[model samples]
Target: MIIIFIASLILFAFLYMVSRNKYDEFIEPLDEKEFKIKKIMPIGFWVMDKINYRYASKYDRNLLNKTAELNGGVYAHYYLRVHWANKITFELMLLMFLLFINGAMGKTDMELIIFSLLVMAVVAYALDKDLENKVSKRRLSMQIDFPDFLNTLTLLINAGMTVSGAWTRIVTDTKKSTPLYSELRNVMLEISNGKSEIGAYEEFAKRCRLPEVTKFVAVITQNLKKGNSELVDILKYQSKECWELRKHAAKRLGEEASSKALFPMMLMFFAVVLVVVTPAIAGLIGSV
Candidate 1:
């Protein structure tokens, strides 16, 4: 027992040392060139590149470039992979500890361990799904509110402000009300920090990942490039379209909700009838 305890302690110490080393490695600062090198040097990047090359060969390379640009270039991919790998490694260690505890307790049932793993897998899957749903709902709310935001921009533009100027105004006006407002504020800062207006807009669109925002960006980008004067009118039209779509969506949702209530409503009605009729039938039988 003493030997086992010592061995366990030594194993834990080794894990702690390894973890400390990895943590230090992760936290080490890199110069911009080194950052770029590490970003491109990961095994994951080559795999992703090959996959993207094969799958999206037909699409405009510009789209991929745009995505990478918004992500702060290819190095962001390396950071993401490193983070994911660390998480996996941590989870593996946890599983190993659980197994080790079971072994130390002389509980060597493979079936129990398998069942525990399956339960953990299910729990993790459920948590992931819940998180995904929450994110989707938040994104949908942002999309729903975006047209009002666009109209505000149109108003600002019509009042003689440039596009970037309008964004700055919107950021100031709406920063307290919504996450989208906060995001726009950050974009304005990026613009102020030497990023071009188009680049900022592109980043915003990519972050939002809504088709409406993408279309709006594309239109606004072209208009800006051509020095078009009718941008306010275009924005107004888009805003109106967004409102109409929202109204239609609300109507459809109302109809579906009513449909869902129908079955439960009928069940309740039938239950009430049975309650009323049952007493009457029992009294009739008693009288007979």
Candidate 2:
């Protein structure tokens, strides 16, 4: 048993080292300037510290930042936390399962430990899939609201407000009620603090990466450059298209719900008929 425990520890250490190195290979370090900026920002600082503590290397931080950059860089901290937490949770679960299996099977500790590592690998894969699904759902919801947001901007612009002024008005009016509203509000704040409208819009597009938002930004940027006056019409058309899409989505959801309920509804109907006829059938049999 003692030898087994020693061997298990060695194996676990080796695998952990291998995974850590692979994670390092996947990430490139940020420059000294970016690293310093990350340290100053509260959220970035937390993410950096968390990654360092969990991963025991700077490479983990790079991996997380790269992943976030790939997704548009706005939610890097959130993604890092998600990935770290998921890995920790899976590891803990695997450890517990291994301990349980060892006690039940009277196996050597090393065998159980190896089995636990295998389980953790499987769990990590499943957790990644679950996270992807969640992110996709959130992106879809944000996209659904983009057209209405664009229309609101267009209306404000047409009514004699400057683009910045229109965004400020919308920010006040929205009061951050929706996800899109909050994101827009942040963009507005960025603009208020000296960022150019075009730069802010570009950042917003990067964060969202939705086709509608990209197209809207392209149109607005062009109009700004060319002094175009037809933005209001374009906004109206986009709004109408988005509304139609939303309606279609709603209809589809409703049909899916109805289809799912159909089976239970038929079962209930048959059950009610059987209950009503059973007594009459018994009475007729008694007469016979």
Candidate 3:
């Protein structure tokens, strides 16, 4: 009893000491050689990684890469290292939690271990979901900003600027720190570094990896290389299409907002009904 508390305390103290020494060092697998799977990781990591990689086939690499890119992860391996490191931390933390729970509550070893693993599984799943949510947020930002970008480009191009010039102008003038504008800024830098207009546009499309953006880039590239004629009309068509997509996105957002509000709305309704009925029910009970 008292002895168990002492043991748990010592175990958690040792965990803190281990975390202080190992936490930052484990997360810095960012050097060039870190990707090469040789001597950079901890000693026993190879065994754990061997077990982890067996399940790696279950996840989508392209989706993971895109999510990583959205979060400024240049290489997929950087995120992988962070994920595994965090997972290990969770494992240790949950093990300690189970130990403490067992010591404090007199739970059996099997019961505590099973409960801990179940909780750890849920938390681990939540970590993957967090990445998916990040990707969705970036996509939403890009969708919301794309329409304004198209309108601005059309306006500048119609105002006697070449496509490349209009693009650079928009990149410089816009103050919105969205993913779309950030990518545009990158494109602007690429152009400034002597990259051709077509190449920059192509890279932007690839980085964005959106259907609408890819289509728009293809339009720009085609018009830039071939003779530019009726470009304003083409841009106007794109602007119209962009506005339609924007409206659709807004409607979807509204629907999602309404759906989220339903739970709170139901709670409020139940509260109001209870307020009206509670006194009546109490009076009836007293009479009976």
Best by TM-score: 3
- Total clashes for model 2: 0
The TM-scores of all predictions, comma-separated, are 0.59, 0.61, 0.78
lDDT of model 3, residue 46: 35
Off by over 4 Å in 1: 1-13, 21-75, 78-86, 93-97, 100-106, 123-138, 244-288
Between prediction 1 and prediction 2, the one with superior lDDT is 2
Better of 1 and 2 by TM-score: 2
Tens digits of lDDT, candidate 2, 70-144: 344765765565456445534543565566566566656676677677878887777656556556655657767
lDDT of model 1 at residue 173? 66
Model 2: lowest-lDDT 10 consecutive positions: 34-43
Candidate lDDT scores, in order, read 0.63, 0.65, 0.72
Q: For residues 1-288, could you state the per-residue lDDT of candidate 1 as single tens digits?
A: 335445665764555554444344543543444233332223323333435533234332433343333334544444444433333333444555666666676756787678758855765455345435544655656666888888888898899988888877777766465556666776888888999889888988877777778888988888778877777888888899888766766676688789999999999999999999999999999999
lDDT of 2 at 8: 56
Cα-lDDT of candidate 1: 0.63
